[model samples]
Target chain A: MQVNFWDRNQLRLTPVFFLAPAMLLFTVYVVYPIFSSLWISLYEWNGVGEMFWVGLGNYIEMWEDDRVHTAIWNNLIWLIFFLLAPLISLGLSIFLNQNLTELRFIKSIFFFPFVVSPVVVGLVFSQFYNPEYGLLDFFLKSLGFQPIAVLSNEEIVTFGIILAALWPQVAYCLILYMTGLAGLNREIVEAGRIDGAKGWKMFWNVILPQLRPATFIAVVVSVLGALRSFDLVAIMTRGGPWGSSTVLAYEMVEQAIFNYRMGYGAALATILFFLLDIYIAWFLFRVWLNEKGRL
Target chain B: MKLFISIIVTVSVVITTAMAGTLKITQNSSNANTQKLWKEQIIPLFEKENPGIKVEMTIYDHEAYKTAIRNFLQAEPPDVVNWFSGNRMKFFVDQGLFEDVSDVWAKNGLDSQLSAARSTMTVKGKQWGVPLTYYQWGVYYRTDIFKKYGLGEPRSIADLMYICRTLKKNGVTPFTIGTKYLWTAAGWFDFLNLRVNGYDFHMSLMDGNISYEDNRLDKVFDIWGDLARKGYFIENHASLSWQEGQAPMINGDAAMYLMGNFVVPNLKEGGLSGKIGYFQFPVIDGNVRTWEEAPTDSVHIPTKAKNKADARKFLAFLAKPKVQSMVAEVEGMLPTNNQSAAPTDKFLKIGFKVLSESAGLAQFYDRDTNPEMAKEGMKGFQEFMVKPDREKQIRKRIEKVRKRIFKK
Candidate 1:
């Protein structure tokens, strides 16, 4: 059989064409909703009534909304704590990576939390924080300390929820670190050892730098996870102890779906989207700059 | 070719069997015994009485069913779905989404059976749904706790404060509530609002004829703030579900809960059925005792339903005295049909007594108010619970929302 140049090229490219379906599905389901939500932010609709063009009214409302302010503050706390949580996990992973007798079991136990769903994690932690019957309260009472309602008081509720959120997140980071450690070059470690690089010096100069890819993945996921902190809040508190635990994602769902204020909810959602975008952009820019310097 | 022919025949048989004019009903009510009775007693009766008809049923958790119903209405609505009365159903009604049963209301004699109070369930002066059951909301307290603390069922605001003081000294949380969903707080606000300002204020607010900053409402907030400041409510009430908070009351760790008759079942589930006691939320002043809280449940046929005739038949069947009595008995609720036998459950009997004795019934806060205003208003109520000092700020914000929501 003879084939023309166009036919030959087309035949060669059929596999790539076959991938179009998945790409189309992704764009339709994921990309389109993001853009549509962004567009909806510019109007005021209560899901049933006529949509009024609100321009930037919803965004402006964010400035005056005390609940939104509290949410943003809580989100900042989540980002800071969530970002550092991964480093702690990585440290633990490295500690456990040493020649310990039960290292395999220890690692598996540490990784167990990540395998659980956030809803289960939230429920379990909420029970732990329960004032009357929870483990923490029981321990505190036994110690003759005042057993506080960790999930209720406005002063500490956000911190309690974030602690719950960090459990699964730390496990996630550990998995990444363990995988990164597996890919580490033994030759490079030996070369550092031969050059008198040992212990902290060895880890700081050689091992840490090599773990950059894993660290980048960890930070990105953590930041995104912190910004999208809804399931934990929903399961644990539903933005309560009087809206003290509301995050933007939860507020968006509550307003858009339950409250039927689609436009206002979209506006809140857009703010979350922008906040996430800025952090992700900064992260990528830093990575790009570092790569350029290496080049 | 033989296999393809066989597959086509099988598919046809399945479709024919599945779509045999069967009526599908979905509800969020999850009382297992009631569900069993509905299947074994009601369904069989409904099916046998109307030969060649079948009934299929599905139940969901309340929030899940709300989401499901909203989605289904936009896609494939059921023949009949249980729903809330008042403003919640109005959105569906306004969309031309529910079947107008004004004729059915008159034909089944519900117009007379249900009374003028039932008109709240109507939209645009047309009856769009059937009121299945409703019950009174009041203060449910642990009698043992009250007796131990030397307190009695509060009849007035001063008496209620006295009881709170007694309970506080005794180291019990004066009230137990979970406001995680925000609307539960509205129950307190609604009782206070009604007690402080009476039924007229509530009706005006529902009609969008009253301002959020009305002095009458301000007085309600004042009382709410006073209770909050006095530490009458459980700390961290916002972190728990209403059911979770019920535990403290059951265990005598908390002395009281402001709730509806539906909570009696939960109290029974908590093994406090005999221990629980009730009274109308104490009046702010002696004159305000006439106002009462009564939220209703109703079933409506959607306009877009494929089986409207069957749905209407089901509605008519539900309105029958026998079916009403069955629903009331199994569900432990007050039947809307006057001819329906009174509930045998003691707590439900108390609820019926309260309903009959009250001068008037006010719809629940969330239902009585427009949904848009209700959302913002309920959040304000929650905020007021959290920080009484936020009262002025919440009122201002609510005023802004009210204007925006009900603009002329």
Candidate 2:
């Protein structure tokens, strides 16, 4: 029996055929590299030369390292402070998505940080954080307060970097929220208005339900962004004043590149990966729960 | 079909371009003078003599080149690469990342000519690279500012403190050093440790022979802390990069900077040389100032370099007094070769005198110690500057890293 060349079943398989290249790329670039990193984490290897088996030696060392403790603590600070970006952006999006004069111009001005590169942002913010003649110092001096060295102070260096990172991050979330707000259905808002729902009430009863997808996306992106914060800290503080501002990602790169401790860096990366995975699992679980309820 | 494709892949991997015609040199600088010496002076001269070979030079900024060197060395290596002497070079040498250039040294009689810098380029009894310029570190001061304050270069800690007091009274920072990248802090530690405890003790400590918490180091920290407490260092120094740290000196807000001879060109470029003077960092503990901070910048052939022969030719040329003087003159730095003519710059002349006469040379703290230890040491030094009271805590932190690194 001759098989039909163009049948419905084969046509249905065409999408899978189309997806094969992307799947292969994802497996090679993303999935494989991660597992390889895990594998390398078990060995003591500088980027060059020999690879010696070290098992859990690097992990044990990292466990006792004060810098690692500082990194984890700083990562926590980043996460907690990073939550402010989405919230601020939501408020910004709402305020700006109105009929105001030069609204597009003002919105673009708020969107400015997102378009600029992280390296430029870090450098610019460093000028603001400069001890002398920095904008921050100038403002403080103008206010009759002694200038605070935010980048130099171990206690507040990470916070200073976080504030700078939030500039671009909040802009990113603003753009996302703006897109979400633009697509808002008006009939439900009218119904909410008929019920005298306005402001917080309207937002809670009508607007927010529609914004759930955007909020979920914004939150996921924000959390991921917080965990992967390397550029600002690398460019600004270099995790200095005794490595007080280093997050795990920054510390990992420092160890691997600067210190030539590739195995240890990989182990740190593994730990960071697991930490991020915990948050991801919770997010996925929440989505699963919501999906099951709907089903 | 699978076998055919696998065979093709294996064949492609096995094939490498013939190593001839072009010599690739990766320079770790974008400085116009260094580039000019390479592109105009060195390359033209090299190609004119060889006639059969050409040069393809690639320049990378210092930091980016450092990170990129590791990868490129393993995959498709450059014929020559710019690097520092001492442990920085030793790091790559230990990994066999650098070619053994001892033959070049032997063939060119560079062993005797480059004797002063040989110890720095040598690792485990093998020389791996050649250096043309290595500069001395000392206090570069504002002469007009010092003269106006009726002060001279300090000869002792007491004299230094007197200058500090005068500068402080005048509302000027006694010294300006940016510790943003941490290495500037290492310069302070090196000087303080060398002055208080002497060279051998400081080196032993750097080599991980002595524990950081040992009482001997306490003296060093105590003396340094005394300076810090007296407000002798630039305020908010941790926020500035080493380059930015010069602002106070340029503006006459600071009287001095403890820095290397490489900064001589910068002073001239900034038009601040009219008021500048160079001196050895003031002595402490009544000990002879025997050791000097002399960091050497070198050229290396990566192990996987396609043109090792041409790379060796470049190395030998670099060892010659003529080529060394040409490059070092432009940079306003002293050539590593003892016979090379001193530059026209007075600051470099003093640097040459200090380096040549010093009983021994230190390749600076970061260059002398293991990279990991150097990084931690610099950070701790930075903290020691900011909070003198935390010296013990910082030492403890560094000691832990030292123990882990050295397996002591």
Candidate 3:
């Protein structure tokens, strides 16, 4: 029997056939693991042992856990400051893009940090911040200022690391903004100029709205990057200065892998995943509503 | 056709023979000389002693080694691997991943040759590994700085505090440390914990029989805080490696560094060997103390070892005095075997003396405590170093961890 061309069933199977590869990947890596973690989170297994069912004990204990609170606060700080990183870089990119002389070279140099591995960046910045023979200390001493223990002082430890983290993140944002600028509508910009819209007025009215796609991507990535800040913290301080820099990601690794509290760590990870999911959903919803309003 | 068949058969026989002769071993020790010695001396000796046994060894740096060992133990356990003693080994032992070496220990008379403390190599009354070497952790200081300031090696806590005050007066940092790795702070805490609480208390605390919030731990925190508040450590310690922090100590900018005996190599690498001096971590409360934080290294044969008998033979060969002494000489470590000759390296001699003379040897805090508890406890200790006022809170957190880890 010959199959009918352009039939509804054929059309329905077409979409499934196209999606089969991605669906398989998702099932293996994402969907299955989510349920596996959920099941594991209810047990008191140390990754090796007789798995004991503890019900919601791990999740319940997370409520009174101060480390979790510290981790959450650090995550919030990361999210807040991390957002500013891309904004500042975007602003810088726009400003730099306005000047055409040797711009590409300068942008490339600025973007160099993003190209390097976070582990290498962390090690380099750690040396730069070293108290005794570090460049910062030498500069401070030359200026007759007492050296600061930036890495050890709990009060400023997070900010110290954030500065290191920002180095690469800012570069990333600049690259995104630069790409967005390259694709900007010249005709619309010319129209704005004809309408006497220039400088801040032109940017606010013409350029920024046109850059929404880049801005949205930048924000989403920065938020996720900030929430998932682990490598730099691990390399630089290992969430130290007395766990002042203990973000959720580092804490999860510590609890699950190092401490062998696989169940508790999984619970922490699940919470972080859900938290990010909620934030992203809210952000996308806001952006969708804004677009609908524009329409 | 006959020539081609002969060549193919010869190739197949050679491949099979190579595969049959190969013996695999993994070690977590990161010392460069140790790796070199393993390749040049240990492997050759083992191979010579056991004809047709070709050894393949993989070495890991400290942190990577810990993670790699855990990974390997879970996935594909190696034939023979270096591991720590005390509660650290107990976890793997409890999993039945290690071969019981009680017969080997008894046959070789290791029980009487090694110290009672080394019994930590055994779990559930069955010996599971062969102890190779151990070393003391203490205050390694710059002799030039001490001589410049007319300060003697600190004999007591009062003397140490006085030296700290003197160093501050002389525009020198009293101590150099890098808490970036977190466990460096544990060296200080281990000394303070031992001094403040004594040996029995330390054992009890490690075994989870004592609460972390006990006044003894508070007193340890108070001492640590006093050191911090007094500006004893170099200004930017947190940014330095335990080795990098030694630069200030080497340059005479810093007076002392509380570190393991292994730090001597790094100090020497930075061109400060001859200028360095060692002292036992000072006594508190007029007590003449001889406790040392001695982390021991051991080799265990896995139950799933490809060549179990060959692996056991390699472990036995490593336990011999000559092999231990040769390794000690190359690695600048104190050998576990009493019959092994002392390392000729001056720094290693100091370590040997300290380890030999100690009234009691406690495994370094991280090794003495179970790995799970050690992870949280060390982090808490690092936090305590940064914010002393958080002592009560940190103690409570540690107590909770203790309860979770030690729960039956």
> Which candidate leads the pack in lDDT?
2
Candidate 2 is graded, for docking, as: medium
lDDT for B156 (candidate 1)? 83
Q: What is model 2's C-alpha RMSD?
A: 3.7
**Residue B95 displacement in candidate 1 (angstroms):** 2.3
- For model 3, the superposed segments whose C-alpha errors exceed 4 Å read A1-22, A283-295, B1-22, B217-219, B285-289
In angstroms, give how far residue A291 of model 2 lies from its true place. Answer: 3.6
For residue B273, model 3's alpha carbon misses the true position, in angstroms, by: 3.5
Per-candidate TM equals 0.91, 0.93, 0.90
DockQ of 2: 0.75
lDDT of 2 by residue, A70-167 (tens): 99999989998998998999999999999878898999899999999999999999999998779999999999999999999888998999999999
lDDT of 1: 0.84
lDDT (10s digit) by residue, model 1, range A107-138:
88998999998889999999999876789999
All candidates' lDDT scores?
Answer: 0.84, 0.87, 0.82
Of 1 and 2, the candidate ranking higher by TM-score: 2
Clash pairs detected, candidate 1 = A241-B238
lDDT of 3 by residue, B1-408 (tens): 999999999999988677668778986667777788888878987888889888998777877787677667767777888888877787788887788887777777777767634566867778889888777788888898889889999888899999999989989989988777778988888888888878788888888899887776777888889988777877656666676777777777887888888788788888886888999888885563667788888889877676677777787788888988887677666888888876777767877787778767888888888877887788787777666677888888889989977873
Candidate number of the best DockQ: 2
Candidate 1 lDDT score at position A265: 95
